[model samples]
Target: MPLYLQLEARLRHMIDSGQLRRGDVIPAERELASMTGVSRVTVRKAMGKLVQDGLVIQKTGAGTFVSGRFSQPLSELSGFSQDMRARGFTPGSHWLDRQHAMAGPDEAMALGVAPGTRITRLKRIRTADDEPMAIETAIVTARDLPDPSMVQDSLYAAFRARGLVAVRALQRLRAGLATQQEAQWLHLKPHAAILRIERRAFLADGRVLDVTYSTYRGDMYDFVVELTASSTTLS
Candidate 1:
């Protein structure tokens, strides 16, 4: 293999195996060149490939660093707070918009409610360890959230308080182009590819609990699903 390709593979392995964690600054090109007995041009080429692959980022006058990439199990119904905590990261949210409005077409269809039914819509910038991760918007029956102010960190926690725990949920995931507003919130350039997820949650009593639409930074989030084979044969 070429010298640059060899160096690129080594660096890629380090990132994949967590030898280089997210936000960790990589050694300077000169340092890497000396350490690996390669020319500075080879080192630059290796780093450039990593940058193009989104495995690392290069900042002028700063340094190259591992990019943040989070993986989530597609089969599970977990909230943002739960997911982050399971990863040993602090989860937080910054409220963007909170108000009561009549259910729109999409909201009404998802929640199985009338078009004019009042609903509480909450929008926030979700964070993990103080780093922005996603833009989330949640719509719930207004009756369930008489006082939206009472909701603080986790919306799930607030629902539990009202004896409205979500017993099940259906979700869909898609790749979408980020709008200007979404890009601004996620700190990405306009038209950046993002992971768009929509979910409809239900309570034990068969009532629609909430519907949520979230856009996660594509470079920073992944959806994983496991498959198992059944013993029964096809007839």
Candidate 2:
């Protein structure tokens, strides 16, 4: 979590615990600066995030007051498509490329296969509401998923519907500069910041089903996570 977010959580915990009761006027900027022992700018940043999350409301003549929350859980993780559907939003996509071919060096190693092995590959530009958001390229061992043409956009749902069990998965995200092709598809300028997501899909019995690399527009979305202190520690 960002330092500003940590400060936000600290204040939010106070609000949730009734330390700062509802309808109670919060401290002023200078007072919060002294109380929280942080710079006034940091306090403002935290308060702004809380307002954006709808946990607080500010009044010009008065002061900040606690607000109602939507009560999101800490244990929810779903794909973008499923998340939008749950919110009653229509989700759709455009097919970019779908083909089957042999795995190269990196794909072969990640899929736990020998070099020059056959692999099924599917590529698509994922979008919602006509705005292209992400470009997904998935690579799977042909021995596991030979029919790459049948994949639409949701590879996880496809795997489950085909009676394949997806036990667990790992995803890595980092900042990336968009390439020419990626920028064109995502409707962003070249070298724009994007979030690169690389995931490895695994079956129940340790069989690697696929490895997917996706680039998401940084501006339109923010990946939210609920993490505990122990999450940063080794098991």
Candidate 3:
């Protein structure tokens, strides 16, 4: 095996075994080279591969550190709170705004409601283990969710309590750069990569339960999709 690949594998093992942890700074290239009796070039190459694989992150002058990236599977329709709990992270939210308001054109269209229809708007910064991860804005018709204040952390939980559970949802994702406000909320530099997600959740009766727009930090979050071989056969 190549020296660099060997080093990379060793580092990966350390991380997996918890010898290295998220936000833990890695040894400098020179120190790693000295400790492993490898060339600095090989150490750098291994670290670079780790960065590309999202196992570590490099700062301009602060050195490299283990990353705390979370991956969510697109095949499962679950809420952020549930996802984080499954990963052993405590999910939290800081309310930015929560009130009843008239649905705008886009919200109305997404919710299949008339423009100016009354709706409950819930805007908050979503957190995992007390670290901000995304900015979420959710809208639901007043007829469905009469009180937005009832939602303390997980909107899905509130909906379930009200017998408005979402059975399925249509979600769309796109890549973008974070705006200044979004960066402030997510504690990232302006223009940092972000993933924008828009989802319309439906009840078992086919009513739109909620329309949620979320912006997640690209560096801290990953969306995975599973694929299988197509059933179609070539002629």
lDDT of each: 0.87, 0.74, 0.89
How far out, in Å, is residue 216 in model 3? 0.5
Q: How do all models score by TM-score?
A: 0.73, 0.66, 0.77
Poorly placed runs, candidate 1 (over 4 Å):
1-21, 25-66, 232-235
lDDT ranking, best first: 3, 1, 2
Where is the poorest 10-residue window by lDDT in model 1?
Answer: 12-21
Across residues 1-235, which tens digit of lDDT does each residue of candidate 2 receive? 8767888988876664445544667788789889878888988999998888767899998889876332223245345576544434446777776777877898899899998898888788876545576888888877667687666656767666778766677788899999998898988999998889888878889888778898988765555567667657666
lDDT of candidate 1 over 198-233, digit per residue (tens): 998888888889899999999787687888868987
Highest TM-score model number: 3
Cα deviation in Å at residue 93, candidate 2? 2.4
lDDT of 3 by residue, 1-235 (tens): 9999999989976764456767989999999999999999999999999898798999998999999766577888999888777666679999999999998998899999999999999999999779999999999999988988788878888888887788899999999999999999999999999999999899899989999999999987778789876789646
Off by over 4 Å in 2: 1-47, 50-77, 231-235
